[model samples]
Target: MKLYIAEKPSLGRAIAAALPKPHRNCKTHIELGNGDVVSWCIGHILAQADPEDYDATLKKWRMESLPIVPEQWQLKPISRTRSQLTVLRKLVKQADEIIHAGDPDREGQLLVDEVIDYFNISKKKKSTIKRLLISDLNLPAVQRALKSLKPNSDFMPLSISALARSRADWLYGINLTRAYTLQGQKTGYNSVLSVGRVQTPLLGLVVRREQEIAKFNSKAFYQVQAHLSLQVNEAVSFTAKWQPSDNCQPYCDEEGRVLVRALAENVVKRIDNQPATVSKLESNEKQQAAPLPFNLSQLQISAAKQFSMNAKLVLDVCQTLYERHKLITYPRSDCRYLPKEQLKQARGIVNTLAKSSLPCNKPAQGANTSLVSKAWNDKKITAHHAIIPTEKSPENISLNTFEKNIYLMIVRQYLVQFYPAYIYQQTKISLLIAGGNFVSQAKIEKQQGWQVLFPKSKKTQAADEQEQTLPPLTKGQILHCQQGELLEKHTSPPQSFTDATLLAAMTGISRYVSDPAIKKVLKDTDGLGTDATRAGIIDLLFKRGFLQRHGKAITATEVGIALINALPEMATLPDMTAQWEATLTAISEKNASYLSFMQPLTKTVTEMVYSASQQSFAGLPKVAFKPKRGKGNFKKKTAKKPAKKSG
Candidate 1:
């Protein structure tokens, strides 16, 4: 008997429908007719036990229990998700072959493996048992996976690492929450004291930025603009926008504007005019090749920017599209590129999409075979390739406005890759006035390239303007500006982080790190978190009250500020995470030992936890979960007492 264990009920249903002799048996749990019993996990059906789960005595928050460390991690079915657990437990005992049909990602791997280990499923041997892994839940994809069932042992290490992370987080979350909440109660407040493996670092990021803003010292600077005139066919003439000397900032204040006017009024500003010669005029054609595919992070960022969809929402939508609708490939991926072997099949998938019932433009050229970079290596691809649409275009699956937009974003990007590159011409013009120089430039596309799919982005500025080329000017051609206009402008403050910018910043934090090795490691790894969970991390911060959301901007609360300020060190932020991810990547690439890779992290986080506990708990305004309010204003934060030194 071949039993397929899906990640969710909808996926199990889809798998049953895909089978040849599919049947629905709902005696105790849903069983597939193909002699396969398919069951699933609604979410983390099982998880590391909390202290409350261990004993009632441990339930009460206490400080004497400083660090509640569990010698061996325990797993229990999640409370609300128990029904799914019942289904999963029943099928595991009876199935000869258990195919793991979870989403192919770290979290998914852990979810399935944890269940197997908890239920004491014997490791699948080569002859009798099997595990199925696939990114796409379509009929053909599932069939192919079924034909090639892998031994469960192949994914053992990944399962172990994932398990370790989950347990460690549970330990920190439960122990710390208890420790602080109890402390808060003693201090006269009952707010939840939130802490976690990834949440604290995220809170620190917001706090650090706030500090920089508060401590910033404002600076002033200047610019000048000249208003001039030219007779018809008489050549344009105007004062230079730049200051004559390099000693001062090039801005026009009230006095600077007057000086420019006096100089132009007197005609003495005709000090010097030197024509700027074009050193070289070169044009080269380049290809705008298709990208690999969308990973969770990249897709979420794109969706958020394009449709203003939140990260978690996007991930959930993509998951539905993949598992329920069976119309997209894996949604959680770190790779944006596809392997060469996938190229042929990718082309087939694109061609099929062209004819499929789904609303999409047929991608021309074999889109799959279109991967052109070293990034498309099969060796680097794991549980999934990248997020792409499946060949199967299932009918009328309803989606919300945001989900529809996100789905379109992925489909459109896929179609774009198969299209041609955007070809354009760039021109630069330089003028010399009063011996100073100024430059202007414009770019016009010859073709829209892959951008043609999205009409909004396809239109070039030149399309609305004139197709007529600029008047030809040779080297030594002295062309005067007919007019120069200057409008007074205030210096703009640094813009707050947006979804797109934040994702970009998160992925590129290694540049800010000082250590060369650390920087390089961070470079090789994604910034701090995986594309699958980065948004969730941010969301957790908001839920825990460490970060308060105001419109689109996220700011740290006073309590959040105090926590970071009290931290022993700042190494837990994105920079450090990037460095750790780098080492893990090395392990994946077989260039580093898992032990060496983990030792530093063990040392780092352990010290952070210790430092947190050793410090005096005095002075902290008990955990204040409620946002105190004053009439027409927020209440002031209570002053803190002096903290005792860590003993």
Candidate 2:
């Protein structure tokens, strides 16, 4: 019998549909369709043996067995899916040959490789093993993949990388969780002080941001604006470029302060509706390259930015779209582009999407061949090109609000790449008003390009309702000052971290570090977490009650903030994780040793544990909150408290 191993049951059924058979109706069992047998793993079918699995006494949850590093690891069927394992073992045991049809990536490779290891399939010499690779799950794609297969040995290196990641997460998660939970118990808290390499750093970010929020001191600042005649440059001029006596050194970060101190009555310049001279008009016409296709992280970021959905929520929606609807590609990928060959079918998928709530217009002309040189490298691609719509139009796939939002995002991003570069004329015109240099700029949209299909990009900053930019104008051209005012404002502190920005920070957090040279080196490296796990990392924070979302805003909980404050200075910072990712990526690419990269990190974690435990976190320290009354809040309580009711 020919046996096929699929990553999940739904996927297994999809594969089974394409196979020649008596059409074995897939249930929760491995069954034969005369010529073949198929069974699938929902998730990790087998997990590494816990300390308790190694020694029965360890099951009691005592702290004595500090570092439970097993010399030889053991695997046991995950409790929830033991039945699937039973069916799988029976099939693999009886089969004459087997096909490994796991997803074609590190995690998928690990999932199947470990399943085989758990069953000790190698010990049984009769089953000839060959692996199947499928990039998309449509029937034709599945049939094509079924005809050709490679030896499982070809995926050994990726499997090794996945194993390393899993083991490292286990080692770190197990040890640190126990260490902290035990410590939390000692500290009079009944809750487990949960921690992980990814979780801790993630929680630390929210907590620290909250702390910054708590510590922020509001100060009055202003910008000196001169309301001039319909002269465009003069009406919008800011005082920063105007030097006092042309000899005074400018403020480091106090340009706003200087403006605030200046009297509003001070009229720096006054002019009538004079013909403004065209001093310097520079226009640059550049094509906006199409956005790269949807990688998991990019999808999450865009969804969060556009629809206010969480990363995990986006992933869940995409997963449903990918697996259930079978209308899209894989949901867990980190690339956002399709292959050269996929371009033909991509247009068809875009056309099929005409039935959606947010349908695609006709595929843009030259979208296929106009891929910017920087985005067309085949080497950057691996198992998949990017997330895109499949040629198949799904039927009756009902999606919830979140799912619909994510689906829209994927469809939009995929379709946009084929649209023409957003050709525009960018003009920057400078004007020398009376005594100071003033600048004015505008974007003339010569062509809407692919942007015509995109909904307006959402933002949390001031509601810039103006979606269009003006055409070219001479520096001296006088435009009507329909509305002009010296808007008194404060020097606003940096906005608190949102999940989208937080993910970006984790990817290239070295930018926040103080050391110039090291920061630059770190800048060149990929961020702390991979696209696959970044959402999960954030979810872990929420699961542990380390982070909370208030409406669209993210804040750290008390336990999370305490963890941040209690850490030994290094681990709590963003740059540390950036460095860690840089090193890990090097290790993954074979440019560095994991042991060498992690030595210092291990020491840092150790030091943090000791320091956190030793600290006299005697009382739940009162968290100080400084709330600013936003020129509002104070209102007349017209209705009294019902005259104290019954008093």
Which candidate has the top score in TM-score? 2
lDDT of 1 at 203: 67
lDDT of 1 by residue, 169-218 (tens): 56555555545445544555445556555666656666777777777664
Worst 10-residue lDDT window for candidate 2 reads 638-647
Listed per candidate, the RMSD to the true structure in angstroms reads 6.5, 9.3
How far is 369's C-alpha from truth in model 1 (Å)? 8.6
